[model samples]
Target: MVSRGCCPAKIGELTLWWKGPLWLHKEDADWPKKKNIYCQADEALLEARTVSHVLSTVKYDLSIVEKYSSLLKLLRVIALCRRFMHNASKKERLSGALQAGEIDKAESSIIRLVQASSFTSEIQDLCKSSQVSPKSVLLRLRPFLDKNNLIRVSGRLGNASTLNESQQHPIILPAKGVFTKLIFIYWHDNLMHGGQQAVLSAVRQKYWPLNGRNIARHVVHRCVKCFKYRPAVVKPIMGDLPEARVRPAQAFKKTGVDFAGPFIIKSSLRRNALLNKAYACLFFALLLKQGT
Candidate 1:
């Protein structure tokens, strides 16, 4: 019988002993079964250690580490995540409305989503951080923001800040780079067969993407339908004169008459009375050959 820890001191020693001819001397018990049992135990120990390591990691708090970084970056990331979630939710809702063929409802829902994703307090904070410049789209909206003309409303994408006009309820655009493509696509679909001015007008009523007019014009210019159906305004070529006006004719073949005016004639009788009350001067012209 082999005593535990007697044949070998370390695991390596035991492995060498088992691999060598020394194992042949252990004929008292089944060495193969013991080897299988030992292997299983080692695997179980490794798995237990792995699980413990994972649980230890879960106990730590990562938020404290994130706090050391610039706050603006964190806020921007949070705002971006919020906007993404809001857009996804609204897209689902819009899809449902469109699937039901409720066009008005879909349009209203889209407008609501766009309004919801407008500029918010996070954007204002970002602007105040000096990260955005005067030439930036957000900075250009400073006038509206300062005048209190734009109102902020609670929304899924943080807070929505936009204009409150009846005819032009413009949504302060978010993620200009990404939403510009979306806006162009929407305008193209909505204003199918419409002109650039029409697309611009339609987009202005609901959205205020940067360079919106240029985007609309670009989409219009790229539309095959618009190019194929555009009306041409070329001046028509003048034709030759009619036979009646151009052909020669006999003298007096045609005549035109006109009355000149009423002329007064004085008589030799009474000085105050006229011989004839009035006489109308007459004139006539005849259509003839050049010599006649």
Candidate 2:
């Protein structure tokens, strides 16, 4: 082991290039890029085939992790698992690279089980030392989550749109069909209203709107034949109207009169001219002063 600026890291031979901090990657040619050369400090990692060396070489881990993320440190953990899992017939990647929506459900299921098994001890220890509870593994399985320096929910791929839309519109009411026959008949036949006018008028008078379509629909629904025969709507019981006032001078104003006999009057024009005259009220009481 040798002393770099601060970290006492092991090296093999000082390669003619550089191994920059985790932020800078090989893509940043200026960020301390190195080709195989000389460095003695990395010898321990080389000998151990540790996460550091495998990270540079592992094909699967490199394919998954993005350069710019808090999850970068977890890439080393993935490399370690990749080495351990490589010998098996099944080539398994580590949970650190697990993406939420992007993974197939079946594959995600397996990844979750493996992750739980792999990190069980570390999470327990972290919980004990921090005097706080670790995030629930099951809850973290939620299609979206972001665990710092470990995993991210942003990478998950699945259809959650359908689920989201249903939540937005929960209580959709069923359509209101035709009103019952009884309701229609009662609306149509009331005395305060003229024949069918009473019914139509009543319908309008007591109409209740449905689905924002108002009076037009009310008339339409009340006009149905079945409900029409249901029964004439009886007028509700209200007291009789007050009688009209009549002038005392006007006789027989309300009741018509018939004359019984006529009186004879002589015409001044000629002695032979005789006129039959009788007084009777017209539409209203009228008195004639014929003497003038």
Cα lDDT of all candidates, in order?
Answer: 0.48, 0.36
- How many residue pairs collide in each prediction? 0, 23
Q: Per-residue lDDT for 108-198 in model 2, tens only?
A: 3333343334344433444455221345432332222213212222212235565432232221111232222223334443332224444
Instruction: Give the C-alpha miss distance for residue 7 in model 2, angstroms.
Output: 75
In angstroms, how far off is 86's CA in candidate 2? 74
lDDT of 1 by residue, 113-199 (tens): 443355444345544763345554465444233122332222233233453452333555544433444556556666665777887
Worst 10 residues of 2 by lDDT: 166-175
* Lowest lDDT 10-residue stretch of candidate 1: 146-155
Model 1: residue 32 alpha-carbon error in angstroms: 27
TM agreement with the true structure for every prediction? 0.33, 0.13
lDDT at 117, model 1: 51
